[model samples]
Target: MTERSRHLSVHVDRPVAEVYAFASDPANLPLWAPGLGGPLVHEDGAWSVLTPHGRARLEMTPLNEHGVLDHVVTTPSGERVHVPLRVVADGAGSEVVFTLRRAPGTSEEEFEQDAERVNADLALLKQVVEAGAAGGAGGPAGA
Candidate 1:
């Protein structure tokens, strides 16, 4: 197998829309994602955020109640890889699951390392939304 992937899951105790809205909206990313410090820069629906590690460019494509944020990130060694955010609603809240797959020729260890970071980020996301941050139209700020 040339590619290796890992999936991580977390349950957020907010309404599905609330969780979805906050996580999908680029502007609110920085608030929930402390590890990805600073504000998010969006252009043509793509968001660029600076993290403790460096920078990540996300291509957001949102549909009615479903969306995916395609991520382009540079590893410590400066190699670029593509990751996807598959967001789906579950009952009252949302179950966010991230699948991390390595590019062809990349090793599983590298993919796991990256996936760990992604998992940690999602864990933080769950904490933020479940702790009562996600609420209204433009997120908690507008609430």
Candidate 2:
């Protein structure tokens, strides 16, 4: 029942702030994330989604100058899992990293598959942010 972790990253050809502005919004998850994403519902100040497993809540970090996009997922059974995410500057572009931790009882195959899924999610995030930037969205010029 030991916990293990993996990290996946993607480089987005966009400014850090622009990437953070888009990726940090939980409501935009379904546009990028694959398995875990959904048409999220916001009620009572918390974002909830009807996950395949059950109803789950996404509690993201507060907006800040730092590019910390960390959040916690609370399962229907009250199990809380911490998802460590960050968007940081890389020259004029940015790099997004997602840390996926295998819960106490997850199998090895499941953990590996989870890492792959997270990688896909990060790639999707990069695509979404870059597409937004190319469309003259995300922020003002040089923002």
Candidate 3:
């Protein structure tokens, strides 16, 4: 059974490279995505975050010029959920797309709630990237 998926995107008034640079950094996730809990912790060369579901490990795709920001979140229960994201050029700005998938047994209400949370996170990402561009701050820790 294929899982239901939704492609949610936001347009940011920043260059694709700039947007990708910031969003691809795991260190910057907490700045825009609050659903991931607090700051990231790096241990034994792996990144982890304290989500409401407890400590979850994150496996991210390698940085590339194509603006792929795909990642996998390994839940405490050992469920690995793939998150597909991208930053594509939109004229002088960029479009950030996040594909949210409905896991098996997830209700319609739960899926909708997840989409809402992703939308909020994307909005915050736009705000942060635009603000940083204006203020000349590279990103989290000058990323």
Candidate 4:
């Protein structure tokens, strides 16, 4: 089966290092990614979150200088999913991109939905980071 990936990127009006610093911190997940950002509990070498679907475990990449934010998400049914994320320098600002893969046997609708979700999350990330860079607290995006 050929693997297909969809990329969604957002430009944040902040330095690449600053953006990576904030995004690489798992603690800030809830501030930008509301969907997957819940209270995380570490148990048995994995971070667990009570997702609406069920209990899910996430293993994200450690803080690194290469701007890699990949993560492994395991569902309650024991399915392991890999999500590739990156942050790169874009002139005076930063560009954050998320790669969503279309799993084998996944329906087209499901893939589109996944892309939409990622887009919304990226938008939130851009808003939060830009707001902080503008000397404002992390308020609602576009507020």
Where's the lowest-lDDT run of ten residues in candidate 2?
Answer: 133-142
Clash number for each model = 0, 0, 0, 0
Give TM per candidate. Answer: 0.69, 0.88, 0.90, 0.84
Q: Which candidate has the highest TM-score of all? A: 3
Local error of candidate 3 at residue 71 (angstroms): 0.4
Error of 1 at 34 (Å): 5.3
Candidate 3, 1-114: lDDT as tens digits: 337999999999988778988888888888899977766898999999988778999999987778889999999999888899998888788899999998889999999999
lDDT string for model 4 (17-122, tens) is: 7788788776678778876747777777767787877888888897676788899999889988888999887878888999888989889998898788888999
lDDT of 2 by residue, 1-143 (tens): 34877778998998887888887777778888866857689999999888777889999988877788898989988988888888878888988888888888789999998888888888888888788733323422344
The residue ranges of model 3 lying beyond 4 angstroms of the native Cα positions read: 133-143
RMSD of each: 5.1, 2.9, 4.0, 5.7
Segments of candidate 2 deviating more than 4 angstroms? 133-143
lDDT of 1 at 91: 64
TM-score, model 2 to reference:
0.88
Any runs in candidate 1 off by more than 4 Å, and if so which?
34-39, 42-46, 50-56, 67-82, 137-143
Which candidate number has the best lDDT? Answer: 3
**lDDT of all the models against the reference?**
0.65, 0.80, 0.85, 0.79
- Winner on TM-score between 1 and 3 is 3
